[model samples]
Target: MPAPERIPSRGLTDTELLTLLAEGRLTVLGQVRGASNAVLHCTVAYEGEERTCVYKPVAGEQPLWDFPDGTLAQREVAAYEVSEATGWGLVPPTVLRDGPYGQGMCQLWIETPGGGTEPSLLALVESEEPGEGWKAVGFAEVGEGRTALLVHADDPRLRRLAVLDAVINNGDRKGGHLLPAPGGRLYGIDHGVTFNADDKLRTLLWGWAGEPLTSEAVEALGLLAAELAPGAALATRLAELITRAEVEALRGRVAGLRTAGRHPEPSGAWPAIPWPPV
Candidate 1:
């Protein structure tokens, strides 16, 4: 079991990688194969610092008949506290502590530079018009009976990760959870099916579906609707990681995207894309 050594932490600082992923000394360094849970690939350490992360564990979660048992490691630390309340770090510092397979969700391991050959915010284009800086995300198949289009990179870091998967209702934004790090910095990771008080928004970033919400995503959803009101501090740390009806349905989806300034359109009741959509 030996392949874990990437350890960059981009020279540490989001409060020293969330205090070395919440008081380090973890150590697994293995198991992250195709992950449906139990991810591990550890490292952590403390005082005498160390890095690499990604823990997962709440006894290796896997229940999901509609997300309840073991709460998917507190919805992956409430999607890293709503991606650090949308100032847009795009989720990487996660924390929910106590590791070595006990309480779960650690995080902070974002390396990804040339190893992945770069240039891919996802693509496929045989050509049904995902031209100029691409966006499409529809036709896929790609086998004997063909079908191609399926685009993505219109950039602004994937439109601020489709406005943080529409304020964390993200159900499974695959495309291998979009991490592109180093300089062009993009992160996103497996938010354990996110803050679901329903309307589970599955995604491959829908390429700004309805369009219009970027005055820097309406000023980061108006400062994430004043830090999700009701006793802020990000609604008291997302009420210790999700559920008060999924943090009031994540503050009613940032007040329904600040009363629909746009960029939504796909509620034909879920499944708007995400099934090996890479």
Candidate 2:
């Protein structure tokens, strides 16, 4: 697990993502709530319908974000690209970019047929199943919608996210980040804090701790473990964003669990789960 070079955002640039959208369609969509640095909700004008999006200023007063100014946005862009390329199904496609401030990431917004997130996912998690109640609770959208991603245990998709979260060492993956759109489609958002290699997998999605793994989940983990080997080739963005130790840990975690033949346990310690699950 060699450390990847410091190539922020894999190789995709912010403006470049913006240019990916049709030209001469710059328009302000909306305003997002929150004051962490420069978080805001924005919409980018696109073909046919106006795609919803998020806006985060690059010139922020935060350190260690790689891009203290505008790096997170760029990294997010790169991450989305990688996920789309690898068919990881973790993130949405980058529809367009407004120089990092806002991005038109056009994955199906996970809206119900005609409304915000559907609640079926939540209901399923609340059922009598494994890992049904160990999730952190809070809602915060990087976008403008007041709707939050409804995440619950029992959903194989949730487990898949855990595998990805573990591999990326996502320091934050509250329930809110897992939005359930109108359809069965689930979207994972706020990947800005992802791609680290430390044991920073802090999240509230483990409510149903120690539940048995689904057969499909086991297979997914098996595939992930295979991809996280020592000499594994990765997308440029992930190589630089994740650490060697993290990759090793990811490899070991995925491999060990699959080999041992069990569902993931709520291991390690954290500060009583984050205040908000977002």
Query: Which lDDT values do the candidates have, in the order given?
Result: 0.78, 0.49
Clashes of each: 1, 18
* TM-score of each model, in listed order: 0.33, 0.62
Using TM-score as the measure, the top candidate is: 2
In candidate 1, what are the lDDT values of residues 1-278, reduced to their tens digit?
11112234547667887887888889997998877678988888888888888888888787888877337778877777776776777778888888766788888777787654245678788988999877887888889999998888888877888888878878788777787776567777887887778888879778778888878778878888898899989888878777688889888888988898888878988788878664
lDDT of 1: 0.78
Runs of candidate 2 with Cα error greater than 4 angstroms are 1-26, 45-50, 64-71, 74-88, 95-153, 225-233, 240-253
Q: What's the CA RMSD for each of the models?
A: 16.7, 9.2
Q: Give the TM-score of candidate 1.
A: 0.33
Candidate 2 has a TM-score of 0.62
